[model samples]
Target chain A: MAEGQFCNKSTVNTEEGIRHLLSDTNGKTYYKEMEALEVDSAAIQATFSKTLKSRLKTWLEICTHCGLCADSCFYYLANEKAPNQVPSYKIQSTLGELVKRKGKVDAKFMMDAMDTAWSKCTCCNRCSQYCPFGIDMGIMFGYLRGILYSQGFVPWEMKIGAGMHRVYQAQMDITSEDWVDTVEWMEEETEEEYLGLKIPIDKENADIIYTVNAREPKHYPEDIAEAAALFHITGEDWTVPSVGWEETSIAMFAGDWEACKIQVESVYDAMERLKPKRMVVTECGHAYRATVTEGPYWAGLKDGKTPVESIHYVEWVAEVLRNGKLKLDPTKKIKEPVTYQDSCNYIRNAGLSNDARYIMSMIAEDFREMKPSKEHNFCCGGGGGLNGIGRYRKQRDAGLAVKHKQIMDTGAKLVISPCHNCWDAIRDLEEVYEDGIRWSFLKPILLKMAIIPEHMIPKDE
Target chain B: MLYDYVTGPIALISLVIFFVGITARVVLYIRGLDWRLDRVTYTVNVKYGIKGALRSLFFWMMPYGTRSWRVKPIVTFFVFALHIGVLFTPIFLSAHNIILKEKFNFSFFTIPDALADILTIIVIVSAVVLLIRRLVLPEVRNITDFKDYMMIAITIAPFLTGFLAYHQAGDSQFWTIVHIISGEIMLVAIPFTKLSHFVMFFCTRVQIGMDYGIKRGGMKKGYSGQNW
Candidate 1:
């Protein structure tokens, strides 16, 4: 270890190390301690050597430092165009330098990497699209985070986040029993509206297997109930697995590859066991990105794909509505000015922008696009686990200005975002900016706007 | 003797080194790829990869094709102009072709002397502006290191010496020999230094272009436009 003011240092690759770190301190103390901890030159060099390859090496070498990537970054735009916020500078200073120096960096350099990795970037990949050479800072930063993670230079929430996946197979401590209970309770509670809403659990060979972010079960159980209500109205045969219900991977955000595999493998395991025709993940962005795209590789599947074909919530809902399985009440459509928040994980990263916009057209009468729409839209500011990292609260909030201004410019009071992360970001942005903005996840908005069938309507109503 | 050795023997050695080094580096880069890193198959269409690459390569080359290009109109204009001058001036200049024809009995069609002069001046002026931009811009300066400065200096050296030699600046023979040596140094440095981007740019650009075209741009089998 290079000499510095060494503090709470632990080998976090082990289960015991993660357990100790999670129990002993919170996000703030852990961050403070990690910042002070000495840099492990051996660990950095080992990880760097392992990850160094043709594509990443070329990306670092080929960068011309043209600085065009600065405008594409929301952090740069939101931070008054800070020079440090430039995507090229941010990646080059940390990951690029690490490769250049063969990872022989000091404590000061590691601390800089820690701050820039978690706080400065959310891994939105917007800059990736804008780059002429297609140098993805998001991918580079992700690789950088793994190296940082090996040395235990990680955010407190992210450490706990990966631990949660390792322990409970969810981002939170929601057991299989708890998830089943929540679905049953939601079915009963929402029955008053739909009369008979059934949330089938672990039903083998169901046409659709639905998964959700743990936050839905842990914080917003109503989201689960609302999804149940939609499936009920649409008359689709969907079942939620009691064992692998949670789909979001905080481990992916933390660059903890082991925890990522654990979380994604559980879901894949359920799919293989039950053999659903297709899987529909809830309105979560990163969850969809993880499962649909990245998870197959993490799980080491032969085809590099999930066992069953899976689609996002918006993809399923839009198809259902378009094919006339479910109808939207024209009279009940939102009349107020509304805008759509594009989730980087799904909308940009997954090319679900049009699917989301098509849903918006059906749900809202007065839909407006923010300054940039579709794949060109900026990040929601609270992406890549930044929303949950307490140490970066100030920077995260400050970064919301670009998004806040985008919404204000649209003059939309209601924002319809299809992804859970985007929903949280918009809600938080409205709360902090106090622009009198209101927001919703697609589940609630779909439930409110989706017309109930004549037969399924409540008897009393 | 110095001029003859440099222009005749050393120049040939530099060309051989340049070509062989590039070939070896390309092979090493391909072999260095850890298949485990890319074990998972990309969902995007492999067929459109080349098409996408060409699209982005030429599109980015356009004066205002990208948002970044549009953002700074003057920089875009200057960059494209500089590229044209740098690439064309040396190849089309009549003096260089005469030397090539005398040595190898083969020469490319040459431009008029005055046109060559104008292009040389443009490249020289652009190099100076680019150097100043690197020094002055806070963001660019922050990332710029001694190596970057040295690379920039090496790139401009041949152009500056060629311009002086063409104009018969004091001791024309001396200027011409120095220009030949500097040009050869640049050729040898291409594969070893960051100038590898001259070749690797296609690889990086095409890979990303394919990424956008197949995966995120929704060119998959079932999911087409509007359906996405």
Candidate 2:
């Protein structure tokens, strides 16, 4: 009902007399079903009563309408600072109102809530840091999204993303055999350079169980290759399970709670089966968040922990560097004015800020810190699955302007982003800004700078 | 007759409801917290939970402690001043202390009457600025429902009436009665309405601090090399 609130101006808000527009870019089948889906108010009310817990109920009751969370959100700051863009307004107009009305919301109201849930806010949780009452709008939005998903009003990719995790146990459609082939393929390509390099599969009692983002195998197998080589040179024993190898949960992003449980249990299942000493996730932010931080709770693990110890890719790299297990060639260090993207998932959510800085200090000669670094760094605008939503591309780019300015202000030619979401956002941001900025995942930079032991180096060479 | 009933019984009832209602709200939320989902706390380094909560509470209490508070120092000043005046003036005012001394045979320390007057004036000025900000600022105005405007009015009523009654600007007896009634109403509203934030702020800080502490590896005991 507010201005600049809908994802698209033509987006139909009510199932009754709703306009049907073809969606070509976002997931085709899901978007069509969503468009045609009935707006069942009774179902929405039933779902609300079922899900409303004490924490959210109390939070909803306590908000003072201070409008303080406005500047804390990039969506509010970057979108010309509209009133509706404010975090409080976004949640209040949608979920807050839904609660106040006891979920007597109409089809149009649900549509408006859907718009705010997905498009207006990326659920970055930055606002939670600044909220005087600690009203985590991100967490509230996560709950709101569950309501939306139950009523079949979720975004295109989200529905499909949840489906992917449910059907494939991975966010992508890659089968178990395909994942193994990709891991082996990467090892084959990289094994020539480093002796004793192996992509072990389902190796029980290994020291490490390495889980990777499904995106790595589908789009960038080189990341797997680089990880294998680094592990080989460090003399670390790690195995990738055929099943439960995909660590990223788009279901988590989609707010499909049941699917989130299914997805995270897959990884936890791997940990219980293989009995690794620890699990090390790849350089994907949400993957680390889903499997390690939030996944434990979803799977009902004790004290919010995985079965074995779990570490981020950055943490493992930083630890190896510190312990002298991984050595970097001084000559290959990043020489230009370089900046590190403080990824939201691990750095802010998981407290891996020091480890990322350690890696930056180790590898970069001219490392420049963003103005607000560490836990306070702004979101990369693509978090909360903003990168893949085709319908909200313009809004996503507008939000990118906030991070774009943060990056450009450092005047760094090269930006090292350790998380896949941040890296992807940078890549997309660079496409538009074209500031001659080079973006990288931490794996590539580490692989480039890491020194291979002479003994581990090929004897023929 | 109305004054006798209002001051004698209604005031006592208001106090009972205010304290009992707020306690029940806090206890219910804490009790209802699903150990599986909401109450996420650290395992090894539980000290970080206390430390983080204290840090968040301390930083948020100061005028320019958080960046959000620092963004608009002018608003922060009004908000901080308003809160200080609202919290302390009711406790330390001579008239209220005198009433407490008469009823309970005890009284807390009292501020100089001049200082209380100044604090009351600060509260009114801050309330007006906040109200104006809500009306004029488009970002604020959109979220400004009738209930928000009512909350502001309810918050300022006792202070405004007390200031008028103290100065004998109007019918002094009437204004005093209004002040007493308004103050009682405000207290009763706290546990029932959004005004509950006064006490809920501490509860939320405790919950959120643990959330951040456990996630951030505040004490470096985190499973990940979250030595950050």
**Mind giving the per-residue lDDT tens digits that candidate 1 earns over A1-461?**
22222233432344555566666555545555665666677767776677777878888887878776878999998888889899999998898787778778766787789789999998888887677678889888888887887677777778778878888899887889998998899988988888778999999999999999898888899988888888999999989998988889999898898888988999999998888999999988999888777787788775556799888888898899899998888988999999998888887777777778888899889999997878778889899999998878899999999999999999888888877777888889988978789888877777777778988897763
lDDT string, candidate 2, B95-144, tens digits: 99999999999999999999999999999999999999988888778877
Q: Evaluate candidate 2 and give its CAPRI docking class based on DockQ.
A: acceptable
lDDT of 1 by residue, B1-44 (tens): 89889988899999999899888877776676543464323443
* Candidate 1 pairs with clashing backbones: none
Q: Which residue ranges in model 2 land beyond 4 Å of their true spot?
A: A1-33, B39-48, B216-228
Q: Which window of 10 residues has the lowest lDDT sum in candidate 2 chain A? A: A1-10
How many pairs of residues collide in each model?
0, 0
lDDT of 1 at A356: 82
Q: Which one wins on lDDT?
A: 2
lDDT of 2 by residue, A42-161 (tens): 766777666677778877877777887888899998989988799888898899888788767665677678878888877778888777888899989988988887776777677667
TM-score of chain B of 1: 0.88
**Local distance difference test, each candidate:** 0.80, 0.82
Candidate 1 residue-wise lDDT at A315: 88
Model 1 CA deviation exceeding 4 Å by range: A1-29, A32-38, B38-45, B98-109, B214-228
